[model samples]
Target: MISISETSTQRLRALAAATAAALLLAGCGTAEDDAPTDTDVSASPSAISLPVTPVTIELVDPGAEPRSSLTYEPAGEQSVVLTTSSTVSQQIDDQAAQDFSTPEITLPLTAQAPESDAGGEIRLRIGTPTSADQRLTEALAVAEGSEAGLTVTDTGAVTALSISPNADAEDAARAAIEQALNQAVYRSISFPSEDVGVGAVWTTEQQVVSGLTLNQTTTATLRERDGDRLTIDLRIDQTPESATLELPDDAGQLAIDTYTMSGSGTLEFDLGRSLPVSGEVTVAGEQQYSDPEGTTVLRQDISDTLRWSTP
Candidate 1:
């Protein structure tokens, strides 16, 4: 058993190391300080476009017995790889990391699922910023808690994520899962892009350990030229679980085939060309999970609208 303090220490060390490396690499480039290149787009005054991108969630439970660590390693092509490992053992702690943002599930296991030996890694190539990520950057540049459109609190850490918890156990769990997915998309957006003047590029690849075959597609749309405001929309879908958890051969199952997550918001970047961007996120989606029966399961839909902010 590991103490919470110990777990925090280990995580701090890993975060420190990763942050240092990323910063060192970032130092090679000059910072953007001048007035932003404002490309005002005419978007529908009431609509925001969602971006399609995969969001990865690694769970870390700092308790008497530590669960796992979220690690970020540099990959070729200026990309970063994220993986999670259990503090208890060397095996990649999938359940822990995957379930972190969600509530606890105490279902009794009736049948033992076969252990998988498949091992692969997911990579997010950070080349250019996407429209959603860039819009977020602008929103962050001048975001205030009062007008963020979503309720958000800054914990003063390397990341700021939203938590949309559903009151129902399963629903809450699904909300957390959705939040993680959105954050993963956010990570893709976080990477600065040289190709676009004011957006980020997001790419994803899934690696499996044994029997599971996984593939996900994500896309995002950012428009600010409809009426006089900016809107960002994002959507992500995974192939449905099959005998091997591959995309279901049939399309009807496709609805339940892959896990679908999405989010969108209206952003106001008209503040004096300086700080303080405001927006609200109104998003919804379904969460897929394996039940105590080990049968592929799906939870009720989850959605929310809250204020958001960045500083």
Candidate 2:
């Protein structure tokens, strides 16, 4: 396993760019008033807390060893492309798959976005099985898998990002180009997804993350400035839960019982304007299987940030 130091931890602090912050503007309106002066106007930070949720579904195992990474791409007016990749590994009981038709599992993941001007394709492959499903009833039966354990490794990659001339963006493009030159800003962007989607992922709550597994419960508050900017303050947490993987008992695979976990963190964001963000995470989890009942558990606390920009 890889070791983490204070210096490495501070670098991770930059990951907060992934979450944004708040921007408030002051204004006033009056009937028959030709114009308003700053003397008569004042704006306060919005105190309202609206619901917030996650736009993408991610499957993660916090206990796995952290993966090393490299990013490379060309830059210019021609066409730019960016690529990112990370790997994770964990130990699992071999008998866990006895009841299932297959010996594999599936997880939700994210692909990195390339540089804005990079016109490249983004693709995600399991690097193993592309898809698999287990019966809910079968999942509930086995409390644990066999005594023998196996090593599992997984990788996620974002292969491309594209940028192009926008005829209609003459206005927005101009504003972004101007802003990009001076002040640094972080923006939180959201996209609708038909698969692995959440009903309201932007809520405030705590989250628990285990080995490639995540459970979150939260409440979120959000305020929007026209359609351009949004401010959000939220609490998120992840913990392990008792998950049972059931396969046909006749399949001779080990039944598996998952350990439970939980934790919470604060997340703040800026829609169009970027701000520095920081937070912490704590979680615990273990893996076990039926028959001889073997177990593996892990616990950790983490904090990190990344440069973030959204459109």
Candidate 3:
């Protein structure tokens, strides 16, 4: 058995609350100044609509000759099985590392295009998620048969997203599902307007507000192309927008001393499909925060992998 002092217990609770709030806002895709404090998952899909932020992709090099537009061509109905897994480790101050890792989660989804092509809407229905962890399985029980609606452009830009979660779901579970959907819908590579062949290079910039505001940049290079299938390499970097972070509920403020995050990965995309074929990304960072109690250092490691297959 483990025992925690009263003061430590209070600190842990505050940390838990702050972490939860951060995760909920991370998926908003809005700037830090405009992000909402809380997300309403029980509301109607339209009422819970997420702000649409345009991703700007600038081409640095067109690469070799034989360049062609990489665009999505929606065909008939499609079904895909996505296997995703993530691990997170966080250490605060001099305490032991905390294990917040998530077991491998397998989600089967179906995508259908709208009858009219005017709006370019795609409706996705997410089936039940399977996980080896009993706690995660219980938390995701209400997520079964949830749906996500997205409006995307031919260049793989997701203009709008709406998620509908079960009304009876817990706040933490609902937030987790929403965050997962947000990443699944928006993390795909958005092709540039200009055509490019193998070795093409481009970069995209976006802002994200988790616990702290971060400017995220991704550089992508086309490694190979075969018909509608393409393999791309991705490098991601993140920087804090400010040095001070105000914790929710007036818990306390943290003055960031130093922060660094960077990662690299590869993705396989098919223009004929609604989602990526396979991909994996990993990010690790460390930061020092100071408060009235004292200075605390946090180190985090996070990773996610995706696998898709036609049913």
Candidate 4:
């Protein structure tokens, strides 16, 4: 895996340009505007506590290890060749039945003291890929570079970032890094503004792309809780939005008319310590991309799971 945080600016910029064809994204479940308050709230058999007190919510670093997988499936034959730093790869099989999954990527979740009460900023440091697939490894080569940074709110929204490669980076790479950063922002879980027990649910919706082309929404519910061990049910749904991709030199353009992705999973939180235990979400969606020559479709049904290490 490439150490993007420690990588030279030039290399990081060039790498982003290399992998821009894959930019599918989605989000977790949402919480309602008004969550139940501790004063007047229902209690559950299990005991779970929110960060009502000043506590830090962070991701304990798990030294170089494969964490997540992102796969893309185009609807039709891939006309263009997706070349890594190496040779032109046909891992997907020339527009045949194939789902291209990038190497396992670890969300370098290292942050300073986050004041949950004040909702401070947390800087996430990305590292390298652990996937054995060279194609995927090359495509997702910038997760760990000193040149790349993803600044997110304690609430789990990506406010600002240096993920876009330097001016030397390509349009595709810059755009892709932006997409990846936003998708990965979910790695930081958001806590309820106030204290609540199991059964309390909340919703979150955010606009990812300009003109609202890629809008996403998520719903999170505190399902079962037992002392520090708590189980939260999660359901995430994406808005079905589409747009056409403007091809260069009129080589032909690919526009996505049908696009929607969603995930359903569970999250376990340690209220006593005010930290995340583990979470897993199963996301599945299909998109239709059309160009001059013909139409291309992309579909994905995959599982993304994460378990935070003990401090």
TM-scores vs. true structure, each candidate:
0.26, 0.25, 0.81, 0.50
| Preferred candidate (TM-score higher): 2 or 4 | 4
Please report, in order, the local distance difference test score of every candidate based on alpha carbons.
Answer: 0.25, 0.22, 0.65, 0.38
Candidates, ranked, lDDT: 3, 4, 1, 2
Instruction: Encode model 1's per-residue lDDT on 220-308: one tens digit a residue.
Output: 33333222222433343434334322221221121223344444544433211111134444434443433233332323333433333
For each of the candidates, the C-alpha root-mean-square deviation to the true structure, in angstroms, is: 23.1, 24.6, 4.7, 17.3
User: Which lDDT tens digits does candidate 2 get at residues 1-311?
Assistant: 11134442222222111110000000011111212222211221111111112233232211112221111221221211111111112222221211101112221112332345433322211111112234422331221110100111111111111122122223322222212211111112221121111222333222211112234543333322223223333344444343432122122222335433333333333222222122222222333434323332211222212222221
- Who is ahead in lDDT, 1 or 3? 3
**Which digits, one per residue and each the tens of the lDDT, describe model 4 over residues 91-129?**
111243333343333333333333444343333333442
Model 1 regions lying over 4 Å from their true place: 1-188, 195-218, 225-233, 236-258, 266-276, 287-298, 309-311
TM for candidate 3 is 0.81
Q: Over the full model, what C-alpha lDDT does candidate 4 score relative to the true structure?
A: 0.38
lDDT for residue 248 in candidate 4, whole number 0-100: 33
- Tell me the lDDT of model 2 at 206: 21
RMSD (CA, Å), candidate 3 to true, equals 4.7
Shift of residue 182 alpha carbon in model 2, Å: 30
Best by TM-score: 3
Count of backbone clashes, every candidate in sequence? 47, 67, 0, 27
Residue 129 Cα positional deviation in candidate 2, in Å, after optimal superposition = 31
lDDT of 3 by residue, 93-202 (tens): 66777766556666677887655554876877778866667777787777777776677887787777767666566665565566666556535678898989899999
